[model samples]
Target: MSVKGQYSATIVIGVCGVGKTSVGHALALALNADFIEADDYHSAENLKAMASGIPLSDEMRLPWLKTLAEAAEAARQKRPVVMACSALKRSYRDLLRDKIGKVQFVFLHGDRDMIADRLVKRADHFMPVSLLDSQIATLEPPTSQEDVIAVDVALPKTEIVDIVARTMRTRQNADMTALNSEH
Candidate 1:
């Protein structure tokens, strides 16, 4: 399941409470890669806003995305990395791609009610259930052409992880074959 030669890093993206962190951690472990929580990169002000049920503006998130892009590059130098990020917008993913080439994304797809239920049950998290609407409102799911794999978050975490790993491996192999054919 390890993407040792296919990609250097992957981003686990979704709306709040979609288990980005949990799944990303498991994915990283399965891939034998480093794991980073994008929430950790959020500024105190951003944290305050989320905790208060306020959604962050694009301007407020740009800097954080840049920081994550830089971190991804750094982490990729040593080993593959899996970063959990709420990259709700395609623009945000584009920004990351601009900064760090060869980055893959795994988008955790789920229903609002399902995610909201998880958020309400979550403890010790800065994000509140109230922000779920905003996050969902802002999300732009990845298309087929995008370098992303959309996985159902409703599935068991272990199953989700397995699917991600298998899909990534298959994609990598296809890419390698394409490259070999081109050469």
Candidate 2:
């Protein structure tokens, strides 16, 4: 399961309560890669705003995103990284890619009702369920051209991890094949 030489970044992106953390952790385990929780990079001010049911402005998020990108780049230098990030907007994803090249994203999406139910049961998270709507509204789903894959949140975390891990292996094989042919 160790992804040797496939050291690019893999991002698990989604809204709150979409199982990004759970899936990202398992995916990292499956790939034998380092895991980073983007939430851990949030500033105290941003956390307070979200905790109080207030959505943060783009300006407020830019600094946090930049910090996370830097952290991810550092991690990538040592090992492949699987990061759990909200990455709600295209600009945010672009920022990550601009900072760390060869980024791949796993976009977890599901019905609002399903996510709301999960959020209600999530007891130990800083993000409030009230802000779910704002997150969803702000989400700019990755387009076909983006180096991304859409995975339904309803799937079991293990299944999601398996799918992403297999895809990474497939991509690695394809990349190797192309490289070999180029010689």
Candidate 3:
């Protein structure tokens, strides 16, 4: 599918405290797309569990994932959307792609120490620093087959956003060229 211009949807994924929300917000602003936080879709119970430093099981996260996927699908129907999600597993990301077609993923990556430091500094967030290890344990870095653009989270938020925006534009151009060549 051609996602040129303002007709694409991207998910910014990473472990907790990897700056997914910050980068996703900047990327959405740069692309002039709708921004959605996957955590916002989490149920109250899930939030409570996370706040209590308990890691959510895969079974507990299915409904939340489905909700985020549905929201992405609906947002993409009108315009491009950028979602900040901690899609730690390939299966979790696959579920999202299954629900919404042709979604791009931006995986923010950083060293565990760096991310844990960030998490410790973060205030007013439901996710506790104690769960950082669990989140990291669950993370399965995206493979080439997953259509992901992995970015180093050590960069400035603006730079990360620029990189993602440029990458999306390039991918869209390539997709369009391929579609046109098939005609």
Estimate the Cα RMSD of every predicted model relative to the unseen true structure. Answer: 2.7, 2.8, 1.8
Error of 2 at 122 (Å): 0.4
Report the lDDT tens digits of candidate 2 across residue range 60-115: 99999999989998888888899999999999998988888778899999999999
Off by over 4 Å in 1: 1-5
**Residue-level lDDT tens digits of model 3 in 76-132:** 878889999999999999998888777789999999999999998999999888998
Candidates sorted by TM-score, descending order?
1, 3, 2
* Cα lDDT of model 1 by residue, 5-108, tens digit: 47657999999999999999999999999999999999999999888988999999999999998998898888889999998998998898788776788999
Candidate 1 overall lDDT versus native: 0.89
Q: How many residue-pair clashes does candidate 3 contain?
A: 0
* Cα deviation of 72, candidate 2, in Å: 0.7
- The positional error of residue 16 in candidate 2, measured at the CA in angstroms, is 0.6
- Give each model's whole-structure lDDT: 0.89, 0.88, 0.88
- Worst 10-residue lDDT window for candidate 1 reads 1-10
For residue 176, model 2's alpha carbon misses the true position, in angstroms, by 1.9
